[model samples]
Target chain A: MKGKTIIKRYPALLIQGGRTQKVEDWVAVEGSYELYLNDTLVDTIVVSPTDLEAHALGYLVTEGFLKPEEVTGVEQQGDQIFVRTATKKIIPRKAAHQNVIYRRREWGEIPVVSSTLEVSPALIIQCAQQIPEHSESWKKTGGIHCSVLFDQEGRVIKAAEDIGRWNTVDKIVGYALLHRIPLTKKILGCSGRQPEGMVLKAARAQIPIVVTKAAVIDRGIEVAERLGVTLIGFAREDRFTIYAHPERVRVAFSPHLR
Target chain B: MKGKTIIKRYPALLIQGGRTQKVEDWVAVEGSYELYLNDTLVDTIVVSPTDLEAHALGYLVTEGFLKPEEVTGVEQQGDQIFVRTATKKIIPRKAAHQNVIYRRREWGEIPVVSSTLEVSPALIIQCAQQIPEHSESWKKTGGIHCSVLFDQEGRVIKAAEDIGRWNTVDKIVGYALLHRIPLTKKILGCSGRQPEGMVLKAARAQIPIVVTKAAVIDRGIEVAERLGVTLIGFAREDRFTIYAHPERVRVAFSPHLR
Candidate 1:
């Protein structure tokens, strides 16, 4: 493992009607891990190595670098990780070279799958409310991105946290893949705003609903709309805005249920 | 024009000693424009279309979708832009498609350029402070990204403001290209953290110095180090962290400069 360091800070917390309290003693760790391919270095990513295997696999697949089955083995030794793949073609060495040249040879464009799940404003609010509860690391360190998987009943089945937002999502997806969970029935909830890359990753994973506490950028909304995915933004406790795929949300005003 | 709207808000100002004050009556205009290539709709980006030609050319180059010289003609029609390329082949219809398939076909690896100019910490601080003075729109709407160009004498020559950080940088670069400004002697001052994309853009422009008021990610630092570019982060008035190219910073014992 690489030399890890904890970052501590005190943040002012506001409680009901404007009462403010200062909370200190929060802790978070930061570190970097270099992923090698059969002893040859491929890429380096900044993340919590709690689920190192999942992070390696998911990052490769999402970044258009590697496929799931292409990864033959993943081994972590000290601070370095070895990712063995079946292909003999090596990824470029220099960062700029790797970005511009080898990016084409390694991966293909991700396909966007349409989602059928109807999400409601209330569900989006619930998703937002549930995000904080799932963020164990953030509550402690005030630094971390969280990804939660929720079923149709609004119950969170799995959640993961990491220093990087993409890593967090990758962990959740990796966990689902490991457990053989049906991702199509789940809603992915995040604390950060939905960017185009994040939306693309979700679409690639075939997740039906993506709910976030922050606003969705124009490009993200457009991509989600094009992919027929339901995107909910500004998902506060009592209100949310449905950017696209509004048909998935079923709103019923029945007195009997109340 | 697609329903022009001016947004006015009160932004919290972080002044000296962490004291906050509400600055009211800040105004900003929000609009979205669609870019087309050879009559085929390509993409829509949300930005102020004041410099339509520069925005179009820069977006294509930065996105790795097209080269500057590859563009045959660029025409704007009522907020809609049409870019004609020399080749008859259409790149792709969607961003995902372009990212996956067409991205690698057009561009190769970015060239790494060695820097000759040494940038100092004091100079980086001066650059950051100079960023605010050049943000004319931010003084109005408090919602624009500023890109400042500084010479060896630490004089600000070109400054551009846009809603997108990349756009702001592109505007400065476009201005430099048009005005025949020697980029090797210039430093780029930005308000946001360094991302891989931002670093790549700077490298492509061959700018020697990149100073930011925000933190730099590990990948950004690594890229800067590999490219031999001077990257200064956390640029406060009297202190800043030199991530890479530390040799560029000349420390002076004079108390007047410190």
Candidate 2:
């Protein structure tokens, strides 16, 4: 797998209080990857050097560079991702550098996710617990953020980790797109803050539910509500906080339990 | 304060085990701000709504768009930051959409920082512990990353927080640049992973020591060593690991303390 090639153990001096000792430590690989839409290089990203295929595809989709179905095949060569597409089209003007955050593609292009999945407080916590089990790179470096796409039954379908939280989410999104998985039918659980960017990714993919152990920001709640997605944060153990579109997540109602 | 203008308090469904209820939660604000230089829109960034001046100036300096001192005044209107610079000499053709990560300036432009600051293990952990005290947004939302520029004595000089780790670093660097603070003697401590990008920021400013409460990736360490920086990671209450250039840090020898 590409993972083993992306992690390395190096000697480090550890200090606890007044003591110091040398030990070998695992640190995730971080590098810059140049992505190309055919021979035309489109962008470069500094990310964990793993899951190059998903990263390239997901980046194109999230950044409004390409659609998943239009991309024929993704091939990787070291720190580059070469994307083969159905037909060559025009690339828009380099946006005003200041407004590149939003692409010209209208948010209306995103489908309203229509998944029938119900997430309980217990289920939210379950997905988080399963992350460490699947994220070997995270266990080694603790420098990576992991994203998992869980099936309708709350079972882990696919997981990807990267040094950048955005990269991790992009990888998972790419994974889902590459495999032709029904995006609306899955839940995305992550190990990074569910900020506006993360919520936007979920909304763009039409993923119905987004869960994280980290807290959600004000804009995250706004986007989740606008896009009709359920955003839950501070999901630890059996405790969680739902910020928006709670109707999408079905937890047993028992006021007496409080 | 711009912070109060951006942050919104909303009711969240808090769940503990089987109990569910609503409580008002404080969440950090996330917004996209378009930045302009002399009315020429230069770049866009998704960040916390506070510290617009630092965000704009830091971005310009870090991206090699303009030196920090060349900027005259920074004005903000909603999500847009208008940068007034001394002159509008040239605006480079926008880099290819795919390769925007790197500006025209090569990595070689970064000066090898040669600060004479010697950090101790106890000092690194001390900086990490102090971060929570200064980060109000993080205390409320836990969705923001904090970065503090510290003097050699392990005292906090200035702190900045944003939704993106890169923004926080850029802000701190901008602060140093705008005020003409000597960079070589300062240490940048952050609440994010030390990746290649983070190290590159420190190197660009010629900051000698970069410390974090998280882990440093392989390339981060590589760049730090090459740039003559001391990189510390996994810094906690009384423990820390030094990845590169240990000679820049001094810990007293006392095997008995182990």
Candidate 3:
């Protein structure tokens, strides 16, 4: 690990129990990073200072701007990232920006996920609970969101943390792609709420199962249902709710149901 | 109050304590909205379906795309919002998109807030605690983020909620602008993390104080300090952390210190 700086000390007044004290607080670091794809300024992201390459790659892959295998090289300077892809085609500038808030209808039909990966409820619960343990920056600053990737056998492949919830998901996606970890049979665990953007990221990346320790919005359910992705929300303390494609999760049969 | 549909019922599987049952769950609604300023397509937003007008106005104001007073009329047709501003000048197409993830360095100098408003910690704590009460959508779906605007005397001016965190802040800003509520002496309470982009919104809108029930990152503090905005974080249960400009919050003198 490069151990990029993710937290900084700041002065703060802590008020508690009718008393106030000045103290040095640990705060998560956030900065604007310029991302260049094939020598073109594609976009800028205000994200945690670390994991610039992963952020760039993940953003490109999940946004349909570029596929993971298409990338030829990646280089990061002070606050700018330059990525060289194998293709010589120029991406429409309008499409690059518009895709940030992409409308499902305008984007045409999204390919439905066809992964047949199956995992037990216990495995998902374990992954969701393990999110906090893998988040070092979050432990230090209490301001970061984390996402973890697990292989088919419930083994951790990699994890990422960012000040932005969506960035964490992109970081993990970028990490998996950079390390050549196949996403088809993996489970994604996030420490943020499940929204349409997040669920769509998993669907686009072909990650069949997504579990979160937070709530899932209506569009998240709709997108997950339409794209054939399994979404689990409110996954904590050994319980969870499956909003879509619950068949991917194996639930034990109980005689009380009869 | 114009009530747009903010929640929808969805089918889900509730799993708890070694049991799983099929149930209907209430989820917060999210949709894609097109925003046109002066007959020019500006941007698209993925936000909650309710409060479309406020969302459009707030987004334009906080993003530095248009001044609130410059807006002559606003119309909502289903999923699209048409905003007619008084100014005839066309907004640069590139500026509209690039500003979404703006780099402070590239945006030139930001106006420093000069408000001298002061309030007691009790008022802020009250405002922070009131966030949950004003969040009707949150109580129903548990997926929405709420932003509340309070006047100098701690009276609630308006509150708004959305599936996206930043949209809540923009909605309230738009609400204040629509109703001609001055933001100079107002306090904004948010139910989401404080980041640089969020702090910049308060600064650009001239809201002097910002309090949140969530954590504040380092860039949020940097922006608040530079822009002369009072920033508070982790404001819950009568305790709060003042991340920047602590002087705006008056602390009562206690003899125990002597």
Candidate 4:
């Protein structure tokens, strides 16, 4: 049987004083592609052609499929990507299993590391307050995911919008990688649930602090605790709970900044 | 400078239908497990441990890092996952070129052969209308993604919700895999953008029909066109655009279904 396909545009809908209006729209096209290596199918990915090469490389590395040095050249002709490997025989073994093993043997068994920063109720409140204002797409389409990068001062630095939560994080990571931004210094603030994958992405980027206004799954907490990455969730006004790595968030003795 | 971590949960205030409610939210959890190949480190993935083995296997296959038969055994202890491979040497050489190669090669190329199915505008409207009613979490927290599976009659069979769009689809796919459900006769209705990843997932599952109420990107269209999958987008009450395989969507001349 065959599959079906459709195309549509995203219009910036504005609601002012209960009146809804279309501001602008952009034509968005979508499709799937299967990736091949040396005439053998490797994997499949979904993305835009605008930055196909970078996406391929980043996805492979992040997923532990390929290393940087092993690739001699990457060429794209039409829709097919040919990756030249320095090794004559690419190991038929899958890299994803290796990643799982590495996580278990090295970092998985480590005791949950304690953080130094002490989070305050006020900080969580402040972060939650910032979400509604920043989520322009949500207000427009009632669809879309958002990832925001913030400094220690709780100010937004870079915000990315996507249809998927993981994709938004990946885009931010990709953006950070392109600009040579120091990821460790930033806190990842997202409007999506903090799952294991979300924490993993932050960990891969070496981001220490992850804050969200949504619920955190158990696996996400477990990963964060193991990675020494602080995981915080349920950001609202004047109240919060610490899951793991509580030391990094400094709680003010008084309401005023010291 | 050493990275800092902050973990916390917050009380959230929800605003729906001009009503305000408060809930305790826990977002981030630390979960870490490593996989080992004969005491060697290969890769790592952060995901919910509920289906660690399946996730590991699926990850390996989807990432093009390992084949199913190449894996000998998969064991999960607590939060850690260990996957043993038959091959002794496994090295990933494409780590550095991850993003670039993936995007360019996959997105730029369209499939050569594909199948398409035609859907009625009324059915599309019904699917769109049903989405909001099925989204419980979104109605509560306004933060979640949904994927619904429907039979040819446009009756929804199952609906899955998740913090990540991919996860929702993965859960549905995993469910189908477990139940031995054939996807060739169903339509995948999503509340997210039709990306190459989403389309590839449907293709991998051999699903024949994909319908979305959101915008479609260029690559998504290309993939559906090539895979012979019917792609439909902007599935609203009165209108939709078909990108490929239009022959399958049988339209009746009469307004009534006979």
Candidate 1 stretches with Cα past 4 Å from truth are A1-126, A129-146, A152-175, A191-206, A226-228, A234-240, A245-258, B1-126, B129-147, B152-171, B191-206, B235-240, B247-258
Report how far residue B97 has shifted in candidate 2, in Å. Answer: 6.7
- Model 1 chain A weakest lDDT span, ten residues long: A98-107
lDDT of 3: 0.64
lDDT of model 3 at position B3 = 41
Compute the DockQ of candidate 2. 0.04
Quote the TM-score that chain A achieves in each candidate: 0.56, 0.57, 0.58, 0.52
Classified by CAPRI criteria, candidate 2 counts as incorrect
Writing each residue's lDDT as its tens digit, candidate 4 over A110-154 gives: 334333444444555566567657765455443455677776667
> Across residues A1-258, which tens digit of lDDT does each residue of candidate 3 receive?
234554444333332222333444433333456678887877665443444565566455434356445777777887777878778645544445522222222213556889989887678777878988986556655676677888877778877655546556655664554345777899999998765667777776678999888876555666778888888777777676666776687664321110
Q: Which of the CAPRI classes, incorrect, acceptable, medium or high, describes model 3? A: incorrect
Clash totals, every prediction = 5, 8, 0, 108
Which 10-residue span in candidate 1 chain B carries the lowest summed lDDT?
Answer: B98-107
As a whole number from 0 to 100, the lDDT of residue B120 in candidate 4 is 57
What stretches of model 3 exceed 4 Å from their correct place? Answer: A1-109, A252-258, B1-108, B252-258
Deviation of model 3 at B250, angstroms: 0.7
Over B51-96, each residue of candidate 1 has an lDDT whose tens digit, in order, gives 4444454445434466445777777788787878879536555431
Comparing candidate 3 with candidate 4, which one achieves the higher TM-score?
A: 3
Tens digits of lDDT, candidate 1, A1-258: 533222222121211122222223221222346767666676554332244454454344334455445767766677776767788545654221122101221113444555566655455567779998875445543334567889977889877654344444555664564356777878999876554546766766678888877555444565677775677665666655555565566544211110
Best by DockQ: 2
**Per-model TM-score on C-alpha atoms:** 0.45, 0.60, 0.60, 0.48
